[model samples]
Target chain A: MNDDVTIATAQQLIEFLGTFAFAISGIRHAAAKHFDWFGGYVCGIAVAIGGGTIRDVMLGATPFWMTNPIYIICTALALCMVILCSKRMERLQNAWFVFDTLGLALFTIAGIQKSLDYGQPFWVAIIMGCITGSAGGVIRDILLNNEPVILRKEIYAMASVAGGFVYWGLSELDVAIQLTALLSFVITCAIRFLAVRYHVSLPQLKTDDEINRVDNG
Target chain B: MNDDVTIATAQQLIEFLGTFAFAISGIRHAAAKHFDWFGGYVCGIAVAIGGGTIRDVMLGATPFWMTNPIYIICTALALCMVILCSKRMERLQNAWFVFDTLGLALFTIAGIQKSLDYGQPFWVAIIMGCITGSAGGVIRDILLNNEPVILRKEIYAMASVAGGFVYWGLSELDVAIQLTALLSFVITCAIRFLAVRYHVSLPQLKTDDEINRVDNG
Candidate 1:
């Protein structure tokens, strides 16, 4: 219902960077699936905005991206970047992983903070964080005809869940807003990094053999 | 924003039948994918109400299913039906096809009627009709890790678009709401029947073919 939504320059920059990083992941994934530039752009935009849009819908608020053209521009930029670096980016590891992790960590914090601002419960905030961190990848996988990583045994979403718990714990201990947020973000990033480096993943609900049997039967 | 979203008995019956059919389609598809029962139920509920939720979000309206408890119950009933005949239902083409087509026809009419009620343009109404009829199936396919059939070549969604045109035309000629809706529904159903019987399908965009090629390459 508000006519204008104003934010500080620093916050705007952070959001842009997060969106850019998320869009890059989407664009690259779409390209790997052999999608055209337009399809890649669509996937990039969807990955960049999908979770926030879902959260907005649940909150009964007009989606934030609808009013701001920045997200669209950022996604287009991501498509350009992917196209230009298609071969080189394919070889680089640290940069892609770092950007993706940054996006995840920032978006997880954003989701948790927004939920709290909306007066939602801790549990709701946790779920929101998970959705923000992984929903885009889920959507991308869907478009590519693959099982979503989150629906399997990925620890990516769990990192967000843990971040939410961190935020709540800090709040319970009367932590300052800036510091609490920083701690949560750090925790999310650290957990994600450790999981990837250590090859840690959650156990599947059913064994592969059992699943294959059901599928065949 | 209304306190009560009550409907006439006849309208309620139609909506329930449509939900039942869509949910059956969703559950059956999930079963074939070997998803767990919980996953199947989730897919069922999604297909039963996914299109309406998307339409409502676009219109900035609170999702209808979120308000009424009836939809959730109807989907549960559908799940029960599928579980009871999961074995036989897998081989029964007539039942699945009948339910899916009926749901598509009814949902297309609902989408157009709602869009017109919201005072959207004719083109917008047509797109809404297509979204309402086909978006659920798209989501179902996504969950099952398959490319959406509508995205490839199905006239299924085009049938809904044609129905929207028919509805608009009838309204311009001062047709009664009931008659225009009924006529649109019939035309949509007939077009779907012809398309399927004649093995008609649209050509894939070059984007898809090129993408597929790149993927295989």
Candidate 2:
């Protein structure tokens, strides 16, 4: 019971930090887009919470955020930080990206572990991990009036999938949970960083011909 | 075999019309938000297809749009209509709302029936109906830089839930499929209209301090 309680507490703290990171990333994007402060703050919160909300609904559970106020409080704090530090933040884009990637890695492992706890199959857990980690950012991009960066260009979702698979493989091998989580986070972040550094991208669907035909018509 | 084919054909037509209606609504919202034509069209198409995509993903089935080209074609047509008829379309707001609501009803039943076909229980099917009906609009609203109107004010999701229950109730009574569909559609629309007309709203959750303290802060 004590171990379980400690794990749960750690999970809560991780989720809060992950939410704060996501909110900060979203606020930075909104700042670049010149959105009003209200818009920026709301978008930041949405980016932080949207994926997990969708995941919960899909799992037929009440949204985790609705049950706990910590996510909201953390998002508010993120907003305050953004408002207070916008000038410094504008020069720290590289640092922000690193923070964002770390947040993604942490969230992906959280998702994988949660799905495993729910007794889902490995593939399902991995997919859920991807959803939990990346869907919020996809929603954030869409809300920011852009095609999802993941679909257009990036190793975003792929990173989550890789991390999920790593977690699954570790579990199958009966690895220690802490070791599995740590390794999964490292692998996910590495893949994301490598993809960015190398401009690695999934092939965009071959829609050029279709676009041409439609345009001509 | 022939009868099955005919049923499938009819279902396909309904699905196409529903998709077109949903996409058009999104495009219109994008336009109203002052997005460029391409952006509007893209937003509209995404809104139209997004709910069904989520449903499929959760059900572990191929996404509906990817399974067939009809959805794509319908979105294309919707986009063309919006572009070509932008001026005249301004006068069709009410007409568009009606069609959008019709599409919502159709999609809700589509989702519920599909879930039932997959042998999910009534509660799950009802929830799926709401997700199919409203999630697209929620997505579109968020992307257009707004809190989801449905969540904020409209009795939108409630209408979907009502229609879902209607479907379940009718099915329990061994009602004819067409009649049940019609009843579900009508009931949902009526509820939605009443909600809009009377400004019906759920009580917003507030902190106790907010309730007791005047916003003199």
Candidate 3:
């Protein structure tokens, strides 16, 4: 029981760090938009907490934030760090990207695990994982008055779904929990990083032909 | 069955109009934040669809907006209006408020009805109604870099909850569907209007003392 509790705590810590990194991304964007410190802080917190809140609400759980202040504190610390080290952080785009991808992988696995634990089917869990992985950034974009990066121009959610299938397959094979986590994480991060590298994405629905049709008609 | 089809068509129209109004609200906020027309359009569409998408996903249904293009067209129209009539809209606060509130009421009832149709309990239906009623605005606020008005000062969610209870009572008593709809609509709008008039709200959590402890210690 103690071992189980410790594992859970470690999982939560990884989640918090990911949430903080996610929040920092939003804060940086808000700062670029000339938002005040308060706005940056709020945006950061929203980006960190929004996805999980949506997932929890959908799953009929009290909001994850309501149960723990760690996420909140992580966001605050992220906010403070971003504000204090704005210039240095701005020069570390590659580092931030790596951190973001790692967070994305972790969040995807966490989402898939939670959905499976809830007794949802494999497909539902995969979709839920994608939603959990990408939603915070979606919320951030909407808040920042931009089109969601996920919806517009990224292979973001695709990576999450791909990772989710890997997770399901491994778990079904009765893989050890640590192995399952590592495999899912590697799959998600690799797919996301490669997609970013190759500029891979789903075709946008509004092709020039479609736009011309609407325009001409 | 003919009557049912007509009702369904009417419901579809209601959904479309609500989507338009809700999207316009998001567009207006985005415009105020100095987003370009495309950004405003996307934000509008997100705000319009976000709540319903959440409701649909939670119920394991296909997201209605993604299945239809009318919502996209409506959001585009809203964007055009905001861009072309920015000055005029700035003077139409009353009109915007009325439209926004009407959309809220309609969406609330629609959410309730849909959840009941899906065979959920009354409490769950009521919560769904509130989520549908308030979540778009919350998303808008998050995008606008503010704590949600509903969470901060609006008695917004309470009205939906009250209307939902009224819906439950009417359904239990075998009231005419139209009458029940009208009742929920009027009660929700009236309560919301009164609350806004009186600046009513739930007490906010006073986290200052807790934060002070964290800071000082």
- Identify the candidate with maximal DockQ: 1
DockQ of 3: 0.06
Each candidate structure's count of clashing pairs:
0, 1, 1
Weakest lDDT window of 10 consecutive positions for candidate 1 chain B: B1-10
Cα lDDT for residue B181, candidate 1: 82
lDDT of 1 by residue, B101-216 (tens): 77888888888878878989878988988888889888888887877878888888888888889998998999988789889988988998899999988876678878999999
Scored by TM against the true chain B, the candidates give 0.86, 0.85, 0.87
Compose the digit string of candidate 1's lDDT tens values, residues A135-204: 8887877776676655554578778878889998999999988788779988998998998899887543
Pick by DockQ: 1 or 2, better one: 1
Task: Give the lowest summed-lDDT range of ten residues in model 2 chain B.
Answer: B33-42
TM per model? 0.59, 0.55, 0.56
- What would the per-residue lDDT of candidate 2 be over residues A134-205, giving only the tens digit for each residue? 888867787688655564456787888889888888988999988888899899999999989988765432
Candidate 1: how close is chain B to the reference, as a TM-score?
Answer: 0.86
Once superposed on the true structure, which residue ranges of model 2 sit more than 4 Å away at CA? A1-17, A208-217, B1-217
lDDT of 3 by residue, B1-217 (tens): 9988987887676667677778888886765555545446546866887788788888876666535567778888887776665565657777667777777888899899889889999899999998888887887776556567778777878888899999989989999998898799889989988888887778878798988998999
lDDT of 2 by residue, B60-176 (tens): 665565445666668778878876665566677677677777777888888898889888999999999999888988878766666778877678888999999999999999999
Locate the minimum summed-lDDT window of 10 residues in model 3 chain A: A203-212
